[model samples]
Target: MFASPAYAQAAGAAGSSSGSTIFMLGQFVLIGVIFYFLLIRPQQKRAKEHRATIDAVKKNDVIVTAGGIVAKVVKVDETEVEVEIAPNVKIKIVKATIADVRTAGAGKPAND
Candidate 1:
């Protein structure tokens, strides 16, 4: 027979392979931690702040809707708001559609 015989790996090589596997798993865990701190945590914080702002909305507050319409809050209900986009022109909108709220006197003059 001209074929060469195959030899099995030494027992010590098995231990090194297991050590490398643990190191690889540790690397994945570290990456997951980095992603949570850099990406996931901040997003959740922003969502919480946005929810608070929406909940604090009341009559006379100026709001910008998700559709980019700027209006004054005429009435605030549990899940909806009545906004006056123009004098005597009001529309009911979902509270969640409000993107930003500007309380009275918070507006600065165009010159400023």
Candidate 2:
């Protein structure tokens, strides 16, 4: 019962501080934009370029497989390919298993 009117003034300041909820939401949105540009966008672009390279593969291309086998393309179809790894040995593998392609100008490998 001895409290003065200053207690009522402090309660008014506390009510206004709750208005910063909008500022907190803006901060979260800013962080999300930064993460997308710095991390997510680059990863997606690299994956898209890699997919384009894989889809453009043709016959006579030299390629390295995921299993570390280097071979020359003997035949190519929609989803599978025949790769000649040795003089007379050819193995059939799925197209998705190819990890890297050696361009024509890269020169003939030692084994070719």
Candidate 3:
């Protein structure tokens, strides 16, 4: 009973537009999944590793701070670290603020 050409044209147009919309939505979801797997997941994993590194800190380790300060660990606690940025110059910072640990044997004065 397809007598009205105008009605058929309108139905076709609506169907095509709906299909395009669904295709766009699927594309967006795929992109989001790819981003999570390729970008967000790796970043989160790296953050977890960095946190573990900070938690395992011990004295005499060489560490770089988030503020770009390089210091040697004088003391390490559950929540904080005392770093000797220079001889006889110790500063306390949060353990989470440490960016990197250079080595385990670092900061130990010779002959100790």
lDDT tens digits by residue: candidate 1, 1-112: 3332322345556659978999999999999999999999999999999999999999888888899888888899999999888778889999999999899667521222
**Model 2 ranges with Cα > 4 A deviation:** 1-13, 107-110
Report the lDDT tens digits of candidate 2 across residue range 29-107: 9999999999999999988887787788788888888988888888888899898888888889998998888876664
| TM-score between model 1 and native | 0.82
Best-to-worst order by lDDT is: 1, 3, 2
TM-score of each: 0.82, 0.76, 0.78
Quote the positional error of residue 49 for candidate 3 in Å: 0.7
CA shift of 96, model 3, Å: 1.8
After superposition, which runs of candidate 1 have C-alpha atoms over 4 Å from their true positions?
1-15, 108-112
What alpha-carbon RMSD in Å does predicted model 2 have with respect to the real structure? 4.1
**Top candidate by TM-score:** 1
Clashes of 3: 0
* Candidate 1, run of 10 with poorest lDDT: 1-10
Tens digits of per-residue lDDT for model 3, 1-112: 6679888898888869978999999999999999999999999999999888888888778888899888888888889999888788888999878889878655443323
Tell me the spans in candidate 3 whose CA falls farther than 4 Å from its real position.
1-11, 106-112
The residue pairs found clashing in candidate 1 are none
Question: Model 2: which ten-residue window has the lowest total lDDT?
Answer: 103-112
